[model samples]
Target: MTVKLRVTQLAQLEMAALGGIGLLLLAAFFFQLVQGELPCAFCNLIRVCFMLLGSGLLLNRIYGINPWNYVLSGIGALIGSMLSLLFMFAKALPTTKPTGSAILGLHMYTWTFMIFTAALFFCLVMATLYAQRDSLESPGHALDARPTWHKGVIALFVALVFANLVSAFLQNGFDHFMAGGQQHYRMLYDGDVMKP
Candidate 1:
């Protein structure tokens, strides 16, 4: 027999998925800090999309599940997948060098494309399934009823969002535009002078 999930169970699954995205963001930071592999403009765009997806998930967990939440995340994934494809295409060019190191024989953009595509598919599936079920968009599914783990996932995503904001400013400085293949943070200084 096919096991159908309750609305609460679906909400919990969304929380878990958001937590996984948080881990991915952390890994990106690790690469930037530990490996010194800075993200290109395209990479930053993909990261932004992840943030958008997380924001939608956050809204649902806080205000209860709604179709608008899916729309927000689905649009993010759709745009992210497109951006990933363009980045991959750039890497395909003869003179275009690869951005960052490859992981598991695939570039970061390639992996992101797969992830965005998967996320888009997931949103579609989940939205359809959620619509088919009974309308439990009531107080029965309030945030206070959820376990602490749900709040933990929200907290993790929120932290990552702020961390990414700080890191972006550090990388690009006040200009808000990072140079291609930038090696050091523009905001950093050496001795008495800032690196220009």
Candidate 2:
């Protein structure tokens, strides 16, 4: 094939890959919401990065006919990758009784981990796209690109993640894991409730 045709093919593939990343991120968000778990600080940061990269790739798919489309995608991918690395390093550290959505650590939300992984995965995909991006709109014939396997992967990831969350909550409830939180303390510890 001609050099121009080859470049176009690569671009299409990159776009499909970006789409895969977006779907994965979306799946993670859906899982978190359906599970009723709230995102903590770190989680929110990760979400922002994912949104940035995801939006960037999406814009490329939309207005990618322009050369600047690749530039936008590159910037978004770089930012997303940097943010992902920061959060991953901080979170990978041992858990420390994290309070209320700290940026350093995540909460007990299952989506916390899932979203982190999702963002990182998307960032990686975007970086690869930057390395390969040439024509922008898509690599090849968008209609022929089958992403069935990608969907399967995302479904499995989210289901198992959310299932784990439900299991943990159930175990905690059954075992009164919040016993410490349930403790009753008096302002004046005279004897019992108060001194006579």
Candidate 3:
């Protein structure tokens, strides 16, 4: 007997996954603000990759699963993994130690690489499973008839991600540019460079 997920259930799962990613980003921010850890240029790039991944999932939740959504998520994961690998071996920031607290003796970038790899794998599995389904109804069809709580949750996740983008812009600059090995949070406080 083959068990299959309903379109609504699949969308809810995707939304939940995106929400979890948002929470993880929030945790990173907490560490940055409270623990005095600063994100380097590569780190910011990794964050952008994650935001891209979440955006793909958000699209899946809203428009129903499509091959393109998985492709988008996979691309984001691939870029993030490549960035983390570059940081790990290329001495991208030779002067600064790896930012954020280490987990299990591995730097946060290493963990991010692992996370992105896992997300890529998950997207592959989901894509394969979705391909086996007989119906391709839009998830929004069910969502329109459902309770408002799920919509609220999706809105909150979008807002959190938008806030993150704003914070990144404020920290980086109006041009959204930062050189490797430069200072972190440079554009904060009206373009005043803060010592990291």
Candidate 4:
């Protein structure tokens, strides 16, 4: 049997999902800073995917859930999964291991693939439920005032995403180029530091 979610419940779920994403991003940074694991280009791409997914949900909280939001988020997830898969199979650079770190015997890129796949599944489920609605009318709480916790969750999501972008810039420098095989962060002053 299919279950329907009320507008408020849906909003709460979106906020929760965004919070989860924010936390995951924070963890990534933790690994980067605490563990001294610099993110390669592929890792940065995965971070962008998470940010994109969070942005979609943030838009939903602000504008209400819509088909287009799901579409965009799903696309982001797909791209992330594809990149993850590519890195998983490709040979590692001479200076670095094939996988950076492992959690539960699976590498971070593998986890990224799983996360993207799960997000895509969630989008599919939500879209199907929305399609089964009887009326075309909105639930009408799109612009309503949200609880403080909801606002906090949204703020956290925004902060984490912005932090990811800044971290990427610091790691990759201002150059438009990205090196997936890079083993360490590249500083702007490091001339010819592209060697892996």
> What TM-score, computed on C-alpha atoms, does each candidate reach?
0.89, 0.44, 0.80, 0.82
- Predicted candidate 1, C-alpha RMSD: 2.7
**Per-residue lDDT over 1-196 for candidate 2, one digit per residue giving the tens place of the 0 to 100 score:** 5656865665466556555555655554564457434344344444454455445545544444443544554455555556555555654657734323333445423334455445445445555655564543453435324356534543443454454345335424333333112222122223454211
lDDT of every predicted structure (CA atoms): 0.82, 0.46, 0.75, 0.77
Q: What is the per-residue lDDT of model 3 for residues 40-62, given as tens digits with 9 covering 90 to 100?
A: 67887898888888878878777
lDDT score, candidate 1: 0.82
For candidate 2, the lDDT comes to 0.46
Candidate 1 lDDT over residue span 1-196, tens digit each:
1334466578778888899899889999999999988776777878899999888878877876688989999999999999999889988988988888889999899999999999999889888977885564662356677689887787889999998888888777777556457777766744464343
Residue pairs with colliding backbones in model 2 are 11-138, 11-139, 12-138, 12-139, 13-139, 41-101
Q: In candidate 2, which residue ranges exceed 4 Å CA deviation?
A: 65-67, 92-196
> Listing every candidate in turn, what is its Cα RMSD in Å to the true structure after a full C-alpha superposition?
2.7, 11.8, 3.3, 3.7
Quick one: best lDDT, which candidate? 1
Q: For this target, which candidate reaches the highest TM-score against the unseen true structure?
A: 1
* lDDT of candidate model 3 versus the reference: 0.75
- Provide the lDDT at 162 for model 4: 81
Ranking by TM-score: 1, 4, 3, 2
Task: Give the count of colliding residue pairs in each prediction.
Answer: 0, 6, 0, 0
User: For residue 148, what is the lDDT in candidate 3?
Assistant: 82
Over 4 Å off, model 3: 1-9, 91-96, 142-149, 179-184, 190-196
